[model samples]
Target: MSGIFLKQADFFETNGILFETGGFFLKQAEFFLKQAEFFMKQSDFSEESIVKK
Candidate 1:
């Protein structure tokens, strides 16, 4: 459980960095947007599974 939580936290942290950096890229920021969206979805999925169990 701790391992999963840590992994999720890391993903969220990376996503935050990508999102912040994306601000400077303007036209090419879509890549970071996609990355952030993917991580966010994964985080939500993890939370939902934890809740279910």
Candidate 2:
């Protein structure tokens, strides 16, 4: 607490926020990837159906 150049408490708080933000972005990326995969599967199914008919 004392003699810390940058204030240890503030450093930890900022670090925690950074981690939370990183996690949020990662979840967003994962959600978008899943969405894209779903669309890809749907299009593939549609193509197969069209070819069958």
Candidate 3:
């Protein structure tokens, strides 16, 4: 009985670690996406300014 309980606890612990890792990666991806968008908008603004001149 104890062995079974230990196995279940181990499984949950592993899953928790995996979820934390996934969450970290997700945050990093969002940060990069926002950065890319900011750069794109800046480039667009410069292009428009040059065209007007």
Candidate 4:
């Protein structure tokens, strides 16, 4: 009975860490996507400016 309880507790702790890690990864991916989008826009604007010149 005590062993079962210990196993359950370990599972819960591991699940919490998994959830936290997933959230961190999602946030990091979003940050990178936004950064890429910003650079793309900047590049497009520069290209247009050069074409105008």
Worst 10 residues of 3 by lDDT: 1-10
Candidate 3 wrongly placed segments (more than 4 Å) = 1-20
**Residue 31 miss distance in model 4 (angstroms):** 0.2
TM-score of each candidate structure, all chains considered together: 0.49, 0.61, 0.61, 0.61
Give the alpha carbon lDDT tens digit for every residue of 1-53 in model 3. Answer: 23443444455556556777755555555555555566667778888999999
Candidate 4 TM-score, C-alpha based: 0.61
> Which residue pairs does candidate 3 place in steric collision?
none
Model 2 Cα lDDT, one tens digit per residue, 19-52: 8765655555555555556666777888899999
Which pairs of residues collide in candidate 2? none
1-53 per-residue lDDT for model 1 (tens digits): 34444455555556657787634444334454555577778878999999999
lDDT of 4 by residue, 1-53 (tens): 23444444455556557787756555555555555566667778888999999
The C-alpha stretches of model 1 lying farther than 4 A from their native spots are 1-27
The predictions' CA RMSDs to the true structure, in order, are 8.4, 16.8, 17.1, 17.1
Clashes of each: 0, 0, 0, 0
TM-score of 1: 0.49
